[model samples]
Target chain A: QQPVQSPQAVILREGEDAVINCSSSKALYSVHWYRQKHGEAPIFLMILLKGGEQKGHDKISASFNEKKQQSSLYLTASQLSYSGTYFCGTEPDNNDMRFGAGTRLTVKP
Target chain B: DVKVTQSSRYLVKRTGEKVFLECVQDMDHENMFWYRQDPGLGLRLIYFSYDVKMKEKGDIPEGYSVSREKKERFSLILESASTNQTSMYLCASSFLPRTEDGYTFGSGTRLTVV
Candidate 1:
């Protein structure tokens, strides 16, 4: 089944911060995050395997909660370059990875 | 850098025509995948190959097939094009079993079926 993402769309000004959440009904062994610009393919950002582990890239970071079967992506001090759609792909116990609908983020300068 | 290359950036085809989308990866990854992206559905996997001459069906495999004749190349074939098949197709490659790194994707092919 596809994961569920909260706040389908979000807008922020420069230096602002936001968090996008992804929740799955099934137990997840891993959660992968990716970003995609308009008219482009999705680019890998980071993958979280163990629960309670946090990974960061630039101003972006993410955390995975194994017991909750959820993951959250954090964008700190948002920049114009961060304007894009972010997707969370969840790997359930079956090991089949599936992507969520994605959260469209627009950062204004 | 690990590079995944798709043969075409844009393609136009008529209904009922056969379409082939080719992808090549230089990272020597063991797994290659084909997926189609639509407006709201996100990415739907069509097929994947774990090894040369080996293929597996993904979530949505109907109306699509795959071929992996060489270790570095994988092809997605649309037996008969339909209007519903017109979308952006993406190809990705990954090393066997998930590690820290994830799949590397190609630029993608925007196919238009009329």
Candidate 2:
């Protein structure tokens, strides 16, 4: 089944912060985060394994709670370049991965 | 970096016409997937192939079929195009155990059926 994402859309000013959440009904082996700009393909951001670890890169970070089957993406001190849509993909196992509906984020200058 | 390439950036087709969308990946990934992106609907999986001649029906597989005759290429076929199928079609490829590094997606093919 496809995962669910919260907050369909959000608008923030430069240097602000935002959070996007994704939850799955079934147990997840891993969670992937991606961002897509207008008229472009989605780009991979990071991946969190089932070990319930937190990973960070630049001002973006994510946490995966295997027990809850949920993952959250944190964008700290958001930049204008961060304006785009964020999607989380949940992989129940090695066979397939399903993506969330996505959250639209707009960061203004 | 892995590169996934889709044949067309935009396409227009008439109702009842057969449409083919092609995807090629430079990396010899073991898995390839086809998804359709619609407004507020996110990415809906249509089909996926794990290896040559191996196919699986995804969540939304009706009206869509897939072909993977070779390892580097996977194709999506619309038996009879309909207006409702007009959307952005995305192709993605990943190594075995897809969650490893995540999927590398093609730029997408925007199809408009009339």
Candidate 3:
């Protein structure tokens, strides 16, 4: 099933913060985060495993709640480089990975 | 760094023409995937391969077929192109399920069926 992502689009100023949430109806083994710039491929960001682990990359971080079947991506002190469409890919089980509709973030100068 | 390359960045084909989108990964990963990205649908997996000569249907595989002749190459074939098939196609590669790095994707091929 496709995961649900909150805030279809967001606009922020430089150095602002934003959060994108993803929720799935089924139990997820892992939740992956990716970002795609205009006309570019989606780039892998981070992945949270089934053990309820959290992952971070510089100013980008994510937390997975196994019981809630949800994941949240936190962008702290967002930069202009963060302007893109963010997608959360959920792996319910095995090797299959399904992505969310995506959250478009535009950070202005 | 792992490199996943798609044969074309843009392609145009007729409605009834056969289209082939090729992807090659140099990392020798065990898994390769083909996905299509539409405006509001996000990335939908069309097919995936675990190894050479092995293929599996994904969530949306009705109009597509896949081929994995060698370990590094995975191909997506559109038997008969349609206007609905005009979208951005993406390819990805991964090591295995147990790993945490997840998938490395190609730049994508923007295919247009007119």
Per prediction, the TM-score for chain B is 0.98, 0.96, 0.97
lDDT scores in order: 0.91, 0.94, 0.93
Tens-place lDDT digits, model 1, residues B1-114: 789999999999999999999999999898899988887778888888889999989989999999999999999999999999999999998888777788799999999999
lDDT of 2 by residue, A1-103 (tens): 9999988999999999999999999998899999999999999999999999999989999999999999999999999999999999998875688999999
lDDT of 3 at A2: 88
Name the lDDT value of residue A78 in candidate 1: 96
Residue range B1-114, candidate 2, lDDT tens digits: 679999999999999999999999999899999999998989989999999999999999989999999999999999999999999999999988654578999999999999
Native contacts retained by candidate 2: 0.71
RMSD (Å) of each candidate, 1 decimal: 1.1, 0.9, 0.9
In the order shown, the candidates' DockQ scores are 0.73, 0.79, 0.81
TM-score: model 2 vs. ground truth: 0.98
Q: After superposition, how far is residue A60 of candidate 1 from its true place, in Å?
A: 1.2
Clashing pairs in 3: none
Model 3 off-target regions past 4 Å?
Answer: none
Per residue, candidate 1 scores C-alpha lDDT tens digits across A1-109 of 8899988999999999999999999888899999999988789999999667999998899999998999999999999999999989988665557888889999998
Every candidate's TM-score, chain A alone: 0.96, 0.98, 0.98
Q: List the residue pairs that clash in candidate 2.
A: none
The digit string of per-residue lDDT tens for model 3 on A1-109 reads 8899998999999999999999999998999999999988889899898878888899999999999999999999999999999999999776788999999999999
What's the true lDDT of residue A54 in model 1?
A: 93
TM-score: model 1 vs. ground truth: 0.96
